[model samples]
Target: MLTVRFARLLLLAALAVLPTLSHALACKEGGRNGNVLITEDIGTTVAVPVTENTGVPIWHSSQRTVNVHCYKDNNVREAEEVYFYPNPRPKQGQPQGVQFGVVYKGQAYYQTERIPTGFSIPQCPSNVSLDKCPAVSFTLSFQVEIATKKPYPGNGQVGINQFEVLQFDGKYGINNAPNSNLVYKVTGLDKIRFIQCAVKVWLNPPNNTLD
Candidate 1:
């Protein structure tokens, strides 16, 4: 009886550890042997006020360049070009929202197919009444590109991305005293990053104002 119980416990322990081992192996299989070489910012920002009478959405855009370098052990190795768009444009049958893309060698490679898993908009101030306060919202558009081409002897590649604005600011009222010169500002982060890629770039403001 003692021998059987010991054997059963051993079996249960092995079963528990098996899943962890398998998961580690799976992560290794998907791991890349490449590192980011550099990232360049090349996108322009624009801010436009939304017409108070015509509540239209504004789209903000930006772009960047990323370089990837692959290596085997301590030495450089050749690897296939992998493309990614952190934010992508909407697809057919999808709602009209901002999307991002990745360009490779002057061509489109990857674009975001869905909305961002993490997104939020600020609520109107409590002091402002709903009737007097106009509703406000904005969208962010981005593009990333690969600057290097394939079949090259070098272990690195390069691409360029672009971001542009459809709109960034909105004017609620005509600078009237009752409205308190209400304006909506859509400001972007100074820097943005993508997973597994080492590229840092600056985002310029669209600087659109209405008084």
Candidate 2:
């Protein structure tokens, strides 16, 4: 039997601590640079028991898709990069539980560095509204590889259950271009890097552990 683990502390912290933006602006058509609205939608993790249905030991690959939309408001200043700093440090010099990364336009981004959006919303036409102009529309997919049939070499466990589904990818911090006077916030947590469209996270158990 393979023990499935999912980390949700970050998710809970994110939702529980979502704060109100004093400088928040409405985001919609004609709305410009109000604020960078982000959404963290949760995804489901399905685990199959070690039975005939899953002949060989099962390997699950979890993923999270973050769709970032930069809406324009009155006080908008164009900038680049959405920063995310992992709260707790990652496990090093030990077995890692999971491995995850971000993908943008066929490019893979690790949590260790600044996350690139590769998108810039052009200034809205003077005569038109923000929506009337092109949007900073793009998707960054988080890829997670949980376990393998073969246990880790030294530590013989289904796999080194060392990695945690990122509340933040790592101790690393991700943010928009430095000194743009602009920043990205995780709804309330504002310090988190995850959310929106299929979280690919765990449910129930503390570590989101599934049997």
Candidate 3:
């Protein structure tokens, strides 16, 4: 009986010292407009301006930044490139020469046919934060140009909306080659799955514009 009581006390003491790790950035899926299911893993929507010229092709210009944090895991990396699921499809107008670019060297923008995410830790006004940046974050610039000279009918969200944000290998963000050294699995959420990755949105003008 003494051995049994002593063992129980030891187990209780060990349990008392166990660390309670909170899921820092694992948010529940199905985030509605302006609503974040979880607080830490806040989702966001980036707005782009599609200006229609009187004679020339419609011009779309936008630059913004995203913020991210990792409290429970370590060695997260920003992906070299992340692809958009369901492929970005324009609903209203046909966007010609539509391309997504990532700003590199703070001088030239690297264009990509796929989508990319940049985290700033706190929302920054510009694609590349002019102010101080967090330890693990960067900016982004997405530009769409050369569309038919037709102004959007009115104004509505016309960009990649509510797509699953996937993570690839890196020391800044999420990774797909889910290895152990730098892998970060969520507490109760799947980072790449639809359950925890509803982290992107692009709104369009109510006009006949393409995202």
RMSD of 2: 19.1
Candidates 1 and 3, the one with greater lDDT: 3
Model 1: lDDT equals 0.26
The superposed Cα distance between candidate 2 and the true structure at residue 20, in angstroms, equals: 13
Evaluate model 3: give its TM-score: 0.22
TM-score of each: 0.23, 0.30, 0.22
- The digit string of per-residue lDDT tens for model 1 on 2-28 reads 999999999999988654332210000
Q: lDDT of each structure?
A: 0.26, 0.33, 0.28
Q: What is candidate 2's lDDT per residue for 1-211, written digit by digit as tens?
A: 1222224665666666432221122222112333332233223432322222211322333354555454433223333333333212344223322224434445544444545344444555667754454445545554433222222233322232233333321111322222211222111111212111242455765666566
lDDT of candidate 3 at residue 159, scale 0 to 100: 28
Task: List candidate 3 segments past 4 Å from native.
Answer: 1-61, 71-96, 111-211
Give the number of colliding residue pairs in candidate 3: 31
- Give per-residue lDDT, candidate 1, residue 194: 21
